[model samples]
Target: MTTSTAPLPDSFDPDTRRVPPLGGFNATMLGIELRRTLRNRRTIIFTLVFPIALFLAFGGQEEWNTTVGRGNVAAYVMVSMAFYGAALTAASAGAMVAVERAQGWSRQLRLTPLSPTAYILTKALLALTLGALAIGVVNIAGVAQGRPSMDVGTWIASAVLTLICTLVFAALGVFVGYLVPSENAMQILGPGLALFAFLGNVFIPITQGSLMWHIASFTPMFGVAEISRSVLTGDLPWYAVLNAVAWLGIFVAGAAWRMSRDTARV
Candidate 1:
């Protein structure tokens, strides 16, 4: 008869074991995250439906075929809704940080060779990927509905600008995720961002030189709204550009600070 026994402590030496760093821009990790994002039904439905419904409701009118800028009203609304969806997707994914933390995923990662920076970068990239998908879906819907014509260059520019601008919302997600429970995160961000979208000239065009426009200019969503829409107009507002950059900085800093605190305690 043979018996199995637990290994004695002296049979293992800590000096003989080495764990390589698991932290980095890993393609495999990204692929897994991408799959997870795609499989998330709630995220997919919410991110896709809201903007498309809004576009169908407001963008289908013949009155909207008239030019708003260099592009017609349909194109403007399409772009606005596209970016709106992108923002929502990125923000929601970023806020998953809270859920992961509550589930002890963050602590588990801390025990591994993964670096905090790598973890954050991975989450940000995942959010951005989903954001891009949201933009693409909205634009596809616009095209299917026979949206007004615009230069190919303008279409490409607007998509790229919207993609880049979504980074701020991703950071906001992380910041909120770290600060609150997962259940509360989206509850706060949903209505809050909707209000920001309205104020930022996304759902409706705020009259130029109006007090609402002035207030919208200072809000987080306004800069992205202005720059994304400028593709049709060919006029870049420097103040809005600065506003976008400033908010991006603040969100990035806040996320980093919270992440550091969490990791430090671990």
Candidate 2:
């Protein structure tokens, strides 16, 4: 004879089960991500050193002593280098998802309770943390060099804007990571960012309203570069802000779309 199953309890409700907002993203996952990133020596060194080197190379020029806006050109260069470092670091941090995806780690994550939103959010926070570190190191280097001359208020504001603007690149990194194979992700991103930097006027100052300047205005890095320098120049054009907001929205949407596609495959 077969045994019969017991009846369901009155209090039991399957519909009551629900995932938390942001897929239950919290401090623990963020801490784990931060620790893992800190363990990568090459990333640490590259993010910290490269910008400082660039700053020292170009920011110390005697001609840069010419005063512009609220500070000298040396200060301007320093801010640019800081912004560059932050963007590079933030993008690299976000692109790390490619490595995890390549190793089948993302597939494994699908078995867990964690949602893609949580994973992406954790990575974004990690990117911001690393970006801030890059910004701080570059600014400290500028201070030690004593060539950069800007008021304390301008220094603080510029740094804050630089860090905030890096979120656009963080999203870009995530989108690129999902779009390309792991080995090729950084290969394309690294040089692509450098090119963006040049075209965006991060390396060389293009005169406002010039052909190159107009072209640079549409590039991803242009918004961040202009915003970061805005405090010193005492100008924050509406178009520059629009450029940044538009790119940020595009990249973030792209990342979410790609992440959905990736998870669907699993």
Candidate 3:
């Protein structure tokens, strides 16, 4: 009699799970994102041109080459340019959410079999693919500059990190798009990303050889850029790993919280 009643189950149906068909959903969203990105000439350029332009402009001259110093410029351009993926995806995808909300896209999706979780996953997946494509192009351009010590494994790891970064930023984009006017997304997100890239080690070394560079060392972009370069060069800085993980956790929590708040808007 003492054990007649058991604790309530964690969920209504403990034996069943409700995880989304993330793989298929991700694939579907990726295909959609690719088509959307390709349709826009500007997106194509940002994903491909900017990195190569910077590489050619800076990676070519002997003075700039020497200034690129110890093969750092090639790596910096390669790594820093990956941020464009996050930037572009965040700008478009975030605004798209707001547009969809206003046009009742969410209502259509909700009425169908598409679960809310699946919908969110789709957005994140689209951002991840765009991130990969943008960053992958940058890396390919990098290969033209110098072989360095990079291998398939290095590139693979970098891609994984870049995708994670994209998803995290996409979440933030979701929140920002929800909060700000859809029209202003480009102005807000574009400049924010540019500033991050500049302050971080994208264009130059984070070590900047100055104590005033303290800000870069502590930023999210710095963590991303440092880890990206380290992984590509087979250096693997432990501190960058810790920093990235810490930022990922904080970013994820904040984004999720913000996303939940927007549920009412739709």
Each model's lDDT comes to 0.84, 0.87, 0.61
lDDT over C-alpha atoms for residue 181 of model 2: 71
Clashing pairs in 2: none
Better of 2 and 3 by TM-score: 2
lDDT of 3 at 134: 72
Which ten residues in a row are the worst by lDDT in model 3?
Answer: 61-70
Misplaced by over 4 Å in model 1 are 1-22, 263-266
Tell me how far the alpha carbon of residue 114 in candidate 3 is from the true structure, in angstroms, after superposition.
Answer: 1.8
> Which of the predicted structures, 1 or 2, would earn the higher lDDT when compared with the native?
2
What TM-scores do the predictions have? 0.89, 0.90, 0.73
Name the best candidate (by lDDT).
2
**What is every candidate's alpha-carbon RMSD to the true fold?**
4.7, 3.3, 7.6
Off by over 4 Å in 3: 1-30, 61-72, 83-91, 144-160, 208-211, 233-239, 263-266
Give per-residue CA lDDT, model 3, range 1-266, as digits (tens).
77688856757765665655552365665676568757877656655676567655645544433323234444445555665555555446645666666666766766666666777777766667666777777667767667332355656676576656655566656766666644465567667766776776666554555774776766666676666566555565676677677766776676567656665644
lDDT digits (tens) for residues 174-248 of candidate 1: 998888865588888888789989998898888989988888899999998888888887778899899899998
